[model samples]
Target: MFIRIVKMGFNPENIDAFLENFEANKAKIRNFEGCQFLELYRDKNNTNQFFTYSYWEDEEALENYRNSNLFKGLWANTKLYFNQKPEAWSVNKIAEAQNKKPAL
Candidate 1:
């Protein structure tokens, strides 16, 4: 499995617009072929900084999504609001731990 992490910094005033766009398109993104999971996170100290953590089946799957028109449109809308250039990393999982105990 592979993970894609994107770090984005938006101008405080533009956050709402970015969020609206994400809210409208997140479901489509999550349901895209080969997408295992998707999540968004914010830096506590820097409210305007955010990250998207996504899991994919493999590099090929990731590239497929990146090459799709969906990504091009999303990127076009998202990039304009950035306070600084976005950073991204594609990585393999090294370790993970999850509880298997039943919920109490």
Candidate 2:
């Protein structure tokens, strides 16, 4: 699986606008092809900073979304509210674990 994380810093005054836009598009984005999970995180110390954490089936899946019209439109509106240029990272998960009860 592939993971994509995007960090965005929005202008304090425009944070509300950003949230509104995100709210309108979150469902569509989560339902996009090859998307496994989607989450939004807010910086603990900075109310204006947020991150989007998502999981995709593969790099190709991510690229397809990036090239889609949905992304184009969402990003166009989102960039207008940015206080600083956004940063993104694409990574592969190396390990994960969950506790399980012993079989009887």
Candidate 3:
């Protein structure tokens, strides 16, 4: 699996617009082929700073998403609100551990 994290900083005045666009497109993004998980995070200290965390089946899957019309259009619209250049990282998933509850 592959993990992706995208960090974005938006103009304070454009935060609402960015959020509205995200709200409208999140479902489609999450449901896209090869996408296994998706989430959004905002910095506590900087309200205009955000991150998108997602898991993909593989690098090809992620590239496919980047090449799709969905992404092209979304990126074009999303870029309009940015205060600075966005940053992103794609990495191979190593491992995940979760706590389990014991029976009472």
Candidate 4:
């Protein structure tokens, strides 16, 4: 799977507006083609900083979303609330530990 992480820093006064925009668009983002998972996180010490963690089937899926009108509209609204430029990363999982015990 391909993973995407985006970190955004919002102006304290504009945080609510950012949240409202995100809330309105999150479902559409999650339901987009090849999207496997979607989640949001906030910095422990900075309430105005947030991160989005999502999983896609592959890079092409991610690119398709980025090229879509949904992203264009959401990002246009979202960028207005940013305190600084957003940071993003695309990654691949190398390893993961299993939670369940194997058959003995």
The lDDT values for all models are: 0.95, 0.95, 0.95, 0.93
Model 1 lDDT per residue over 1-104, tens place: 89999999999999999999999999999998999999999999999999999999998888999999998999999999999999999988898899899879
Clashing pairs in 1: none
What's the lDDT for candidate 2? Answer: 0.95
Q: Put down candidate 4 lDDT per residue, 1-104, tens digits, no spaces.
A: 88999999999999888888888888999999989999989899999999999999999999999999999999898999999899999988999998998889
Q: Write the per-residue lDDT of candidate 3 for residues 40-101, one digit (tens) a residue.
A: 99999999899999999998889999999999999999999999999999887677799999
TM-score of candidate 2 relative to the true fold: 0.92
Clashes of each: 0, 0, 0, 0
Question: Could you tell me the TM-score of candidate 3?
Answer: 0.94
RMSD of 4: 2.0
Worst 10 residues of 1 by lDDT: 90-99
Candidate 4 lDDT at 70 equals: 95
The segments of candidate 3 whose C-alpha lies over 4 angstroms from its true place after superposition are: none
